[model samples]
Target: MPEPELRTDRLLLRRWRESDLEPWAAMNADPEVREHLGEPLTREQSDAVAALMRAEFEERGFGWWALEVRATGEFIGRAGLDEVDAGMPFAGVDVGWRLTRSAWGHGYATEAALSCLAFGFEVLGLPEIIATTTVGNVRSQAVMRRIGMTRDPADDFEDPSVPEGPLRRCVLYRIRRDAPPAARRAAGS
Candidate 1:
Protein backbone atom coordinates (compact mmCIF):
# COMPACT_ATOMS: atom_id res chain seq x y z
CA MET A 1 0.00 0.00 0.00
CA PRO A 2 1.11 3.59 -0.58
CA GLU A 3 2.00 5.40 2.60
CA PRO A 4 -0.91 7.31 4.00
CA GLU A 5 -0.96 11.05 4.59
CA LEU A 6 -1.81 12.40 8.02
CA ARG A 7 -2.99 15.92 8.73
CA THR A 8 -2.99 18.26 11.69
CA ASP A 9 -4.64 21.63 12.06
CA ARG A 10 -1.57 23.36 10.67
CA LEU A 11 0.65 20.63 9.33
CA LEU A 12 0.44 17.92 6.75
CA LEU A 13 2.45 14.70 7.13
CA ARG A 14 2.75 13.51 3.59
CA ARG A 15 5.09 11.60 1.31
CA TRP A 16 8.52 13.03 0.57
CA ARG A 17 8.81 14.96 -2.67
CA GLU A 18 11.68 15.70 -5.03
CA SER A 19 11.11 19.34 -4.17
CA ASP A 20 11.69 18.56 -0.50
CA LEU A 21 15.26 17.35 -1.09
CA GLU A 22 16.91 20.76 -0.82
CA PRO A 23 15.30 22.14 2.38
CA TRP A 24 15.40 18.72 3.91
CA ALA A 25 19.14 18.78 3.25
CA ALA A 26 19.32 22.27 4.71
CA MET A 27 17.51 21.17 7.85
CA ASN A 28 19.74 18.14 8.19
CA ALA A 29 22.75 20.39 7.76
CA ASP A 30 21.72 22.84 10.48
CA PRO A 31 23.94 22.39 13.52
CA GLU A 32 21.35 23.47 16.06
CA VAL A 33 18.85 21.08 14.56
CA ARG A 34 21.35 18.25 14.54
CA GLU A 35 22.83 19.16 17.94
CA HIS A 36 21.19 16.27 19.73
CA LEU A 37 20.62 13.91 16.85
CA GLY A 38 24.21 13.70 15.61
CA GLU A 39 26.63 15.50 13.34
CA PRO A 40 24.85 17.73 10.85
CA LEU A 41 24.70 15.82 7.57
CA THR A 42 26.13 16.73 4.20
CA ARG A 43 23.77 17.13 1.24
CA GLU A 44 24.67 13.67 -0.04
CA GLN A 45 23.94 12.07 3.33
CA SER A 46 20.69 14.00 3.59
CA ASP A 47 19.58 12.82 0.17
CA ALA A 48 20.50 9.28 1.09
CA VAL A 49 18.30 9.55 4.17
CA ALA A 50 15.35 10.78 2.15
CA ALA A 51 15.82 7.91 -0.24
CA LEU A 52 15.91 5.46 2.64
CA MET A 53 12.78 6.99 4.08
CA ARG A 54 10.99 6.53 0.78
CA ALA A 55 12.17 2.94 0.60
CA GLU A 56 11.08 2.26 4.15
CA PHE A 57 7.64 3.75 3.62
CA GLU A 58 7.21 1.62 0.53
CA GLU A 59 8.39 -1.49 2.31
CA ARG A 60 6.33 -1.03 5.48
CA GLY A 61 3.58 1.39 4.54
CA PHE A 62 4.65 3.61 7.42
CA GLY A 63 7.77 5.63 7.97
CA TRP A 64 8.84 9.25 8.31
CA TRP A 65 6.69 11.59 6.25
CA ALA A 66 7.84 14.91 4.94
CA LEU A 67 6.25 17.46 7.22
CA GLU A 68 4.72 20.45 5.48
CA VAL A 69 2.93 23.54 6.70
CA ARG A 70 -0.63 23.58 5.45
CA ALA A 71 -1.00 27.31 5.10
CA THR A 72 2.29 28.04 3.41
CA GLY A 73 3.16 24.74 1.70
CA GLU A 74 6.62 24.80 3.18
CA PHE A 75 8.57 21.60 3.73
CA ILE A 76 9.47 22.00 7.37
CA GLY A 77 10.90 18.56 8.11
CA ARG A 78 9.70 15.02 8.85
CA ALA A 79 7.52 13.21 11.40
CA GLY A 80 5.91 9.79 11.75
CA LEU A 81 6.43 6.18 12.89
CA ASP A 82 9.44 3.94 12.41
CA GLU A 83 10.74 0.65 13.73
CA VAL A 84 13.30 0.70 16.49
CA ASP A 85 16.71 0.66 14.87
CA ALA A 86 18.59 -2.61 14.77
CA GLY A 87 20.63 -3.49 17.89
CA MET A 88 18.51 -1.32 20.18
CA PRO A 89 17.87 -2.95 23.54
CA PHE A 90 14.13 -3.11 22.87
CA ALA A 91 11.79 -3.25 19.93
CA GLY A 92 8.53 -1.59 18.98
CA VAL A 93 6.98 1.00 16.70
CA ASP A 94 8.35 4.40 17.59
CA VAL A 95 7.08 7.91 16.91
CA GLY A 96 9.56 10.58 15.82
CA TRP A 97 9.89 14.11 14.45
CA ARG A 98 12.58 16.54 13.35
CA LEU A 99 12.09 20.11 12.14
CA THR A 100 14.18 22.81 10.60
CA ARG A 101 15.79 25.14 13.13
CA SER A 102 13.45 27.84 11.91
CA ALA A 103 10.42 25.75 12.89
CA TRP A 104 11.53 25.33 16.47
CA GLY A 105 9.30 26.44 19.40
CA HIS A 106 6.14 26.47 17.28
CA GLY A 107 4.57 23.19 18.51
CA TYR A 108 4.74 21.58 15.07
CA ALA A 109 6.58 18.55 16.38
CA THR A 110 3.95 17.91 19.02
CA GLU A 111 1.17 18.52 16.56
CA ALA A 112 2.56 16.12 13.99
CA ALA A 113 3.46 13.59 16.68
CA LEU A 114 -0.09 13.47 17.98
CA SER A 115 -1.36 12.71 14.51
CA CYS A 116 1.22 9.95 14.11
CA LEU A 117 0.21 8.56 17.49
CA ALA A 118 -3.45 8.54 16.50
CA PHE A 119 -2.60 6.72 13.31
CA GLY A 120 -0.43 4.23 15.13
CA PHE A 121 -3.06 3.50 17.74
CA GLU A 122 -6.43 4.12 16.14
CA VAL A 123 -5.58 3.04 12.62
CA LEU A 124 -2.69 0.67 12.93
CA GLY A 125 -4.10 -0.76 16.18
CA LEU A 126 -0.78 -0.73 17.90
CA PRO A 127 -0.94 -1.39 21.63
CA GLU A 128 2.00 0.87 22.38
CA ILE A 129 4.13 3.49 20.72
CA ILE A 130 7.48 4.76 21.92
CA ALA A 131 9.65 7.84 21.43
CA THR A 132 13.36 7.81 22.16
CA THR A 133 16.08 10.40 22.10
CA THR A 134 19.42 11.23 23.59
CA VAL A 135 18.97 11.97 27.29
CA GLY A 136 20.05 15.57 26.75
CA ASN A 137 17.23 16.19 24.29
CA VAL A 138 14.91 17.82 26.80
CA ARG A 139 13.05 19.52 24.01
CA SER A 140 12.04 16.19 22.45
CA GLN A 141 11.48 14.71 25.88
CA ALA A 142 9.04 17.51 26.58
CA VAL A 143 7.20 16.73 23.40
CA MET A 144 6.98 13.14 24.57
CA ARG A 145 5.47 14.26 27.87
CA ARG A 146 3.14 16.69 26.16
CA ILE A 147 1.80 13.85 24.07
CA GLY A 148 1.14 11.87 27.27
CA MET A 149 4.07 9.48 27.05
CA THR A 150 5.57 8.45 30.36
CA ARG A 151 9.16 7.63 31.11
CA ASP A 152 10.63 5.22 33.60
CA PRO A 153 14.20 5.88 34.62
CA ALA A 154 14.77 2.16 34.47
CA ASP A 155 13.81 2.13 30.81
CA ASP A 156 16.79 4.28 29.94
CA PHE A 157 19.71 2.52 28.31
CA GLU A 158 23.02 3.08 26.59
CA ASP A 159 22.57 2.96 22.86
CA PRO A 160 25.06 0.43 21.61
CA SER A 161 24.90 1.91 18.14
CA VAL A 162 26.02 5.39 19.22
CA PRO A 163 29.43 4.41 20.59
CA GLU A 164 30.70 5.41 24.04
CA GLY A 165 29.86 9.05 24.69
CA PRO A 166 27.20 11.50 25.83
CA LEU A 167 25.16 10.69 22.76
CA ARG A 168 25.05 7.04 23.73
CA ARG A 169 22.79 7.61 26.72
CA CYS A 170 19.19 7.35 25.62
CA VAL A 171 15.78 7.64 27.23
CA LEU A 172 12.61 5.92 26.20
CA TYR A 173 9.12 7.32 26.60
CA ARG A 174 5.92 5.45 25.82
CA ILE A 175 2.17 5.89 25.54
CA ARG A 176 -0.30 3.07 25.30
CA ARG A 177 -3.39 3.11 23.14
CA ASP A 178 -5.54 3.24 26.26
CA ALA A 179 -4.01 6.34 27.79
CA PRO A 180 -6.71 8.78 28.88
CA PRO A 181 -8.13 11.24 26.37
CA ALA A 182 -7.50 13.99 28.90
CA ALA A 183 -3.80 13.13 28.93
CA ARG A 184 -3.71 13.18 25.15
CA ARG A 185 -5.51 16.54 25.07
CA ALA A 186 -2.28 18.51 25.38
CA ALA A 187 -1.86 18.13 21.67
CA GLY A 188 -3.88 21.38 21.55
CA SER A 189 -6.90 19.58 20.11
Candidate 2:
Protein backbone atom coordinates (compact mmCIF):
# COMPACT_ATOMS: atom_id res chain seq x y z
CA MET A 1 0.00 0.00 0.00
CA PRO A 2 1.16 3.51 -0.72
CA GLU A 3 1.78 5.59 2.40
CA PRO A 4 -1.01 8.13 2.69
CA GLU A 5 -0.19 11.76 3.37
CA LEU A 6 -1.48 13.46 6.52
CA ARG A 7 -1.91 17.18 7.02
CA THR A 8 -2.08 19.32 10.13
CA ASP A 9 -2.58 23.05 10.47
CA ARG A 10 1.09 23.83 9.73
CA LEU A 11 2.60 20.47 8.92
CA LEU A 12 2.60 17.96 6.11
CA LEU A 13 3.22 14.33 7.11
CA ARG A 14 4.24 12.22 4.17
CA ARG A 15 6.50 9.27 3.37
CA TRP A 16 10.27 9.51 3.23
CA ARG A 17 12.07 10.54 0.07
CA GLU A 18 15.68 10.49 -1.11
CA SER A 19 15.93 14.23 -0.56
CA ASP A 20 15.41 13.87 3.20
CA LEU A 21 18.68 11.95 3.69
CA GLU A 22 20.94 14.80 4.73
CA PRO A 23 18.76 16.48 7.34
CA TRP A 24 17.57 13.15 8.65
CA ALA A 25 21.17 12.08 9.18
CA ALA A 26 21.97 15.37 10.90
CA MET A 27 18.98 15.01 13.20
CA ASN A 28 19.88 11.47 14.26
CA ALA A 29 23.49 12.49 14.83
CA ASP A 30 22.56 15.06 17.47
CA PRO A 31 23.40 13.70 20.93
CA GLU A 32 20.68 15.65 22.70
CA VAL A 33 18.02 14.49 20.25
CA ARG A 34 19.19 10.89 20.72
CA GLU A 35 19.49 11.09 24.52
CA HIS A 36 16.41 9.01 25.26
CA LEU A 37 17.02 6.69 22.33
CA GLY A 38 20.60 5.81 23.36
CA GLU A 39 23.54 6.32 20.98
CA PRO A 40 23.39 8.28 17.76
CA LEU A 41 22.83 6.34 14.59
CA THR A 42 25.72 6.46 12.14
CA ARG A 43 25.13 7.70 8.60
CA GLU A 44 24.93 4.14 7.33
CA GLN A 45 22.53 3.21 10.09
CA SER A 46 20.36 6.23 9.32
CA ASP A 47 20.21 5.26 5.68
CA ALA A 48 19.18 1.76 6.61
CA VAL A 49 16.43 3.14 8.83
CA ALA A 50 15.10 5.26 6.00
CA ALA A 51 15.01 2.24 3.75
CA LEU A 52 13.17 0.20 6.39
CA MET A 53 10.55 2.89 6.88
CA ARG A 54 9.97 2.99 3.14
CA ALA A 55 9.52 -0.76 3.06
CA GLU A 56 7.14 -0.62 6.04
CA PHE A 57 4.97 1.91 4.26
CA GLU A 58 4.68 -0.40 1.28
CA GLU A 59 3.84 -3.43 3.41
CA ARG A 60 1.95 -2.15 6.45
CA GLY A 61 -0.26 0.47 4.87
CA PHE A 62 1.23 2.91 7.39
CA GLY A 63 4.43 3.67 9.26
CA TRP A 64 6.36 6.73 10.37
CA TRP A 65 5.30 9.57 8.07
CA ALA A 66 7.92 12.19 7.33
CA LEU A 67 6.68 15.45 8.85
CA GLU A 68 7.25 18.68 6.92
CA VAL A 69 6.05 22.23 7.27
CA ARG A 70 3.22 23.00 4.89
CA ALA A 71 4.44 26.54 4.27
CA THR A 72 8.20 25.98 4.06
CA GLY A 73 8.24 22.30 3.07
CA GLU A 74 10.93 21.73 5.67
CA PHE A 75 11.26 18.32 7.29
CA ILE A 76 10.47 19.24 10.88
CA GLY A 77 10.12 15.70 12.21
CA ARG A 78 7.85 12.67 12.22
CA ALA A 79 4.63 11.55 13.92
CA GLY A 80 2.46 8.58 13.06
CA LEU A 81 0.70 5.38 14.13
CA ASP A 82 2.20 1.89 13.84
CA GLU A 83 1.32 -1.49 15.22
CA VAL A 84 2.85 -2.11 18.65
CA ASP A 85 5.64 -4.67 18.80
CA ALA A 86 5.03 -7.81 20.79
CA GLY A 87 7.50 -6.83 23.49
CA MET A 88 5.66 -3.61 24.21
CA PRO A 89 3.34 -3.64 27.21
CA PHE A 90 0.30 -2.88 25.11
CA ALA A 91 -0.67 -4.47 21.80
CA GLY A 92 -2.38 -1.84 19.69
CA VAL A 93 -1.74 1.35 17.78
CA ASP A 94 1.41 3.25 18.82
CA VAL A 95 1.72 6.99 18.28
CA GLY A 96 5.09 8.76 18.38
CA TRP A 97 7.26 11.65 17.09
CA ARG A 98 10.79 13.05 16.78
CA LEU A 99 11.01 16.74 15.91
CA THR A 100 14.14 18.81 15.37
CA ARG A 101 15.46 20.85 18.29
CA SER A 102 14.39 24.00 16.47
CA ALA A 103 10.87 22.64 16.38
CA TRP A 104 10.88 22.20 20.12
CA GLY A 105 8.70 24.44 22.32
CA HIS A 106 6.21 24.60 19.45
CA GLY A 107 3.05 22.46 19.65
CA TYR A 108 3.97 20.50 16.54
CA ALA A 109 4.32 17.21 18.37
CA THR A 110 0.93 17.46 20.00
CA GLU A 111 -0.76 18.67 16.85
CA ALA A 112 0.64 15.91 14.64
CA ALA A 113 0.02 13.26 17.26
CA LEU A 114 -3.60 14.27 17.76
CA SER A 115 -4.24 13.77 14.06
CA CYS A 116 -2.58 10.34 14.06
CA LEU A 117 -4.48 9.21 17.15
CA ALA A 118 -7.75 10.34 15.64
CA PHE A 119 -6.92 8.52 12.41
CA GLY A 120 -6.07 5.35 14.30
CA PHE A 121 -9.24 5.38 16.32
CA GLU A 122 -11.80 6.90 13.96
CA VAL A 123 -10.41 6.03 10.54
CA LEU A 124 -8.62 2.72 11.13
CA GLY A 125 -11.24 1.54 13.62
CA LEU A 126 -8.66 0.67 16.24
CA PRO A 127 -9.94 -0.08 19.73
CA GLU A 128 -7.03 1.62 21.53
CA ILE A 129 -3.67 3.32 21.14
CA ILE A 130 -0.56 3.11 23.31
CA ALA A 131 2.62 5.10 23.80
CA THR A 132 5.74 4.36 25.82
CA THR A 133 8.91 6.21 26.71
CA THR A 134 11.87 6.11 29.04
CA VAL A 135 10.89 7.15 32.55
CA GLY A 136 12.70 10.48 32.36
CA ASN A 137 11.37 11.38 28.90
CA VAL A 138 8.93 13.88 30.38
CA ARG A 139 8.56 15.74 27.10
CA SER A 140 7.11 12.75 25.24
CA GLN A 141 4.98 11.65 28.20
CA ALA A 142 3.57 15.14 28.37
CA VAL A 143 2.60 14.86 24.70
CA MET A 144 0.94 11.52 25.41
CA ARG A 145 -1.10 13.07 28.21
CA ARG A 146 -1.90 16.01 25.99
CA ILE A 147 -3.41 13.48 23.59
CA GLY A 148 -5.68 11.95 26.30
CA MET A 149 -3.58 8.88 27.17
CA THR A 150 -3.70 7.88 30.82
CA ARG A 151 -0.55 6.54 32.43
CA ASP A 152 -0.71 2.85 33.22
CA PRO A 153 1.78 2.76 36.07
CA ALA A 154 0.84 -0.84 36.72
CA ASP A 155 2.00 -1.79 33.26
CA ASP A 156 5.35 -0.08 33.52
CA PHE A 157 8.23 -2.47 32.97
CA GLU A 158 11.93 -2.71 32.30
CA ASP A 159 12.76 -2.52 28.61
CA PRO A 160 14.74 -5.63 27.80
CA SER A 161 16.48 -3.80 25.00
CA VAL A 162 17.82 -1.21 27.43
CA PRO A 163 19.85 -3.62 29.51
CA GLU A 164 20.02 -3.24 33.32
CA GLY A 165 20.48 0.47 33.64
CA PRO A 166 18.86 3.73 34.70
CA LEU A 167 16.92 4.14 31.46
CA ARG A 168 15.78 0.55 31.35
CA ARG A 169 12.60 1.13 33.28
CA CYS A 170 9.87 2.65 31.12
CA VAL A 171 6.28 3.69 31.53
CA LEU A 172 3.32 2.87 29.34
CA TYR A 173 0.37 5.13 28.60
CA ARG A 174 -2.88 4.23 26.86
CA ILE A 175 -6.15 5.64 25.56
CA ARG A 176 -9.09 3.47 24.58
CA ARG A 177 -11.20 4.27 21.55
CA ASP A 178 -14.33 4.35 23.67
CA ALA A 179 -12.97 6.93 26.10
CA PRO A 180 -15.28 9.78 27.00
CA PRO A 181 -15.95 12.17 24.16
CA ALA A 182 -15.05 15.10 26.39
CA ALA A 183 -11.58 13.71 27.07
CA ARG A 184 -11.10 13.05 23.38
CA ARG A 185 -12.09 16.62 22.61
CA ALA A 186 -9.76 17.82 25.36
CA ALA A 187 -6.98 15.99 23.52
CA GLY A 188 -7.65 18.26 20.56
CA SER A 189 -9.35 16.09 17.97
Candidate 3:
Protein backbone atom coordinates (compact mmCIF):
# COMPACT_ATOMS: atom_id res chain seq x y z
CA MET A 1 0.00 0.00 0.00
CA PRO A 2 1.01 3.63 -0.45
CA GLU A 3 1.94 6.06 2.27
CA PRO A 4 -1.29 7.53 3.60
CA GLU A 5 -2.30 11.15 4.14
CA LEU A 6 -4.07 12.16 7.35
CA ARG A 7 -6.60 14.87 7.95
CA THR A 8 -7.90 16.76 10.94
CA ASP A 9 -10.92 19.06 11.00
CA ARG A 10 -8.80 21.99 9.81
CA LEU A 11 -5.48 20.47 8.79
CA LEU A 12 -4.26 18.19 6.04
CA LEU A 13 -1.26 16.08 6.92
CA ARG A 14 0.33 15.02 3.68
CA ARG A 15 3.65 14.57 1.94
CA TRP A 16 5.90 17.53 1.22
CA ARG A 17 6.10 19.47 -2.02
CA GLU A 18 8.83 21.50 -3.69
CA SER A 19 6.77 24.64 -3.03
CA ASP A 20 6.97 24.02 0.69
CA LEU A 21 10.76 24.25 0.84
CA GLU A 22 10.84 28.05 0.77
CA PRO A 23 8.28 28.49 3.54
CA TRP A 24 9.77 25.66 5.53
CA ALA A 25 13.14 27.34 5.31
CA ALA A 26 11.65 30.66 6.38
CA MET A 27 9.88 29.09 9.34
CA ASN A 28 13.06 27.33 10.46
CA ALA A 29 15.03 30.53 10.07
CA ASP A 30 12.84 32.39 12.52
CA PRO A 31 14.63 32.59 15.86
CA GLU A 32 11.40 32.62 17.83
CA VAL A 33 10.18 29.53 15.98
CA ARG A 34 13.51 27.79 16.56
CA GLU A 35 13.80 28.93 20.18
CA HIS A 36 13.05 25.53 21.68
CA LEU A 37 14.46 23.62 18.74
CA GLY A 38 18.06 24.83 19.26
CA GLU A 39 19.24 27.01 16.32
CA PRO A 40 17.67 28.20 13.11
CA LEU A 41 18.21 26.19 9.96
CA THR A 42 19.57 27.29 6.64
CA ARG A 43 17.57 26.89 3.43
CA GLU A 44 19.67 23.93 2.34
CA GLN A 45 19.28 22.25 5.70
CA SER A 46 15.54 22.83 5.61
CA ASP A 47 15.26 21.44 2.12
CA ALA A 48 17.33 18.42 3.04
CA VAL A 49 15.07 17.65 5.97
CA ALA A 50 11.96 17.96 3.85
CA ALA A 51 13.52 15.54 1.40
CA LEU A 52 14.32 13.08 4.14
CA MET A 53 10.80 13.26 5.57
CA ARG A 54 9.33 12.59 2.16
CA ALA A 55 11.69 9.69 1.59
CA GLU A 56 11.02 8.13 4.97
CA PHE A 57 7.29 7.82 4.34
CA GLU A 58 7.90 6.41 0.88
CA GLU A 59 10.33 3.91 2.34
CA ARG A 60 8.56 2.98 5.58
CA GLY A 61 4.88 3.81 4.96
CA PHE A 62 4.82 6.13 7.99
CA GLY A 63 6.77 9.31 8.69
CA TRP A 64 6.53 13.07 8.93
CA TRP A 65 3.73 14.72 7.00
CA ALA A 66 3.69 18.32 5.88
CA LEU A 67 0.85 19.96 7.80
CA GLU A 68 -1.35 22.34 5.83
CA VAL A 69 -4.47 24.27 6.53
CA ARG A 70 -7.20 22.42 4.72
CA ALA A 71 -9.02 25.63 3.83
CA THR A 72 -6.03 27.52 2.47
CA GLY A 73 -3.54 24.84 1.49
CA GLU A 74 -0.90 26.69 3.43
CA PHE A 75 2.11 24.61 4.45
CA ILE A 76 2.19 25.49 8.13
CA GLY A 77 4.68 22.84 9.23
CA ARG A 78 4.89 19.08 9.95
CA ALA A 79 3.28 16.48 12.23
CA GLY A 80 3.44 12.70 12.36
CA LEU A 81 4.71 9.60 14.15
CA ASP A 82 8.21 8.17 13.99
CA GLU A 83 10.47 5.87 15.95
CA VAL A 84 12.42 7.57 18.71
CA ASP A 85 15.96 8.38 17.69
CA ALA A 86 18.47 5.56 18.30
CA GLY A 87 20.16 7.60 21.05
CA MET A 88 17.08 7.49 23.27
CA PRO A 89 16.79 4.86 26.00
CA PHE A 90 13.24 3.78 25.23
CA ALA A 91 12.01 2.30 22.01
CA GLY A 92 8.66 2.78 20.32
CA VAL A 93 6.79 5.06 17.96
CA ASP A 94 6.54 8.72 18.99
CA VAL A 95 4.27 11.53 17.88
CA GLY A 96 5.66 14.99 17.13
CA TRP A 97 4.85 18.31 15.47
CA ARG A 98 6.44 21.61 14.46
CA LEU A 99 4.42 24.59 13.26
CA THR A 100 5.21 28.06 12.04
CA ARG A 101 4.83 30.84 14.58
CA SER A 102 1.68 31.89 12.78
CA ALA A 103 0.26 28.45 13.29
CA TRP A 104 0.95 28.30 17.01
CA GLY A 105 -1.82 29.09 19.50
CA HIS A 106 -4.30 27.80 16.96
CA GLY A 107 -4.66 24.26 18.34
CA TYR A 108 -3.47 22.90 14.99
CA ALA A 109 -0.74 20.87 16.66
CA THR A 110 -3.13 19.15 19.01
CA GLU A 111 -5.57 18.41 16.22
CA ALA A 112 -2.88 16.98 13.97
CA ALA A 113 -1.32 15.02 16.83
CA LEU A 114 -4.62 13.52 17.88
CA SER A 115 -5.08 12.46 14.29
CA CYS A 116 -1.63 10.88 14.33
CA LEU A 117 -2.46 8.93 17.47
CA ALA A 118 -5.63 7.60 15.88
CA PHE A 119 -3.61 6.53 12.84
CA GLY A 120 -0.91 4.92 14.95
CA PHE A 121 -3.40 2.95 16.96
CA GLU A 122 -6.18 2.20 14.51
CA VAL A 123 -4.29 1.94 11.24
CA LEU A 124 -0.68 1.20 12.10
CA GLY A 125 -1.81 -1.08 14.92
CA LEU A 126 0.67 0.40 17.37
CA PRO A 127 0.34 -0.54 21.03
CA GLU A 128 1.37 2.86 22.31
CA ILE A 129 2.59 6.31 21.26
CA ILE A 130 4.91 8.64 23.11
CA ALA A 131 5.79 12.34 22.88
CA THR A 132 8.86 14.09 24.27
CA THR A 133 10.11 17.62 24.48
CA THR A 134 12.38 19.74 26.61
CA VAL A 135 10.84 20.41 30.01
CA GLY A 136 10.68 24.10 29.14
CA ASN A 137 8.28 23.35 26.30
CA VAL A 138 5.16 23.66 28.37
CA ARG A 139 3.15 24.51 25.27
CA SER A 140 3.87 21.14 23.75
CA GLN A 141 3.43 19.42 27.10
CA ALA A 142 0.02 21.03 27.35
CA VAL A 143 -0.85 19.69 23.93
CA MET A 144 0.27 16.21 25.00
CA ARG A 145 -1.98 16.36 28.02
CA ARG A 146 -4.81 17.80 25.98
CA ILE A 147 -4.48 14.80 23.71
CA GLY A 148 -4.63 12.39 26.68
CA MET A 149 -0.96 11.46 26.96
CA THR A 150 0.32 11.29 30.50
CA ARG A 151 3.83 11.97 31.75
CA ASP A 152 5.74 10.33 34.54
CA PRO A 153 8.66 12.21 36.04
CA ALA A 154 10.56 8.96 35.96
CA ASP A 155 10.34 8.99 32.19
CA ASP A 156 12.12 12.30 31.96
CA PHE A 157 15.81 12.18 31.07
CA GLU A 158 18.73 14.18 29.75
CA ASP A 159 19.07 13.82 26.04
CA PRO A 160 22.36 12.04 25.39
CA SER A 161 22.90 13.95 22.17
CA VAL A 162 22.21 17.54 23.26
CA PRO A 163 24.98 19.42 24.96
CA GLU A 164 24.59 20.35 28.63
CA GLY A 165 21.75 22.85 28.53
CA PRO A 166 18.01 23.33 28.83
CA LEU A 167 17.31 21.33 25.69
CA ARG A 168 19.21 18.40 27.13
CA ARG A 169 16.68 17.95 29.90
CA CYS A 170 13.74 16.29 28.18
CA VAL A 171 10.47 14.80 29.38
CA LEU A 172 8.50 11.95 27.89
CA TYR A 173 4.74 11.48 27.76
CA ARG A 174 2.78 8.52 26.52
CA ILE A 175 -0.67 7.04 25.85
CA ARG A 176 -1.43 3.37 25.39
CA ARG A 177 -3.88 1.97 22.87
CA ASP A 178 -6.06 0.64 25.66
CA ALA A 179 -6.15 3.92 27.51
CA PRO A 180 -9.53 5.65 27.54
CA PRO A 181 -9.87 8.70 25.37
CA ALA A 182 -9.29 11.32 28.02
CA ALA A 183 -9.35 14.34 25.78
CA ARG A 184 -9.45 17.56 27.78
CA ARG A 185 -8.58 20.53 25.61
CA ALA A 186 -7.95 23.29 28.05
CA ALA A 187 -8.74 26.88 27.15
CA GLY A 188 -6.24 29.43 25.74
CA SER A 189 -4.66 26.98 23.29
Backbone clashes in each candidate structure, one number apiece? 0, 0, 0
Tens-digit lDDT string for candidate 2 (1-189):
667888879988898988898888889999988988888999999889888878877898877899998999999777888777777545777889998899998899998998888778777888888898899999999998888989868989888777777788899888888889876885565
Candidates 1 and 3: which is better by TM-score?
Answer: 1
Backbone clashes (count) for model 3: 0
Q: Tens digits of per-residue lDDT for model 3 on 61-108?
A: 998998999999999999999988897889899999999999999999
For model 3, what is the alpha-carbon lDDT of residue 9? 81
Q: What's the lDDT of the predicted structure labeled candidate 2?
A: 0.85
The deviation in Å at residue 81 for candidate 1 is 0.2
Give the lDDT of residue 58 in candidate 1. 95
TM-score for each candidate, following the candidate numbering: 0.96, 0.95, 0.94
Which tens-of-lDDT digit does each residue in 80-155 have in candidate 1? Answer: 9999988889999999999998899999999999999888888888889999999999999999998989999999
Candidate ordering by TM-score (highest first): 1, 2, 3
- What does each candidate score in C-alpha RMSD? 1.4, 1.2, 2.9
Instruction: Report the C-alpha displacement of residue 20, candidate 3, in angstroms.
Output: 0.6
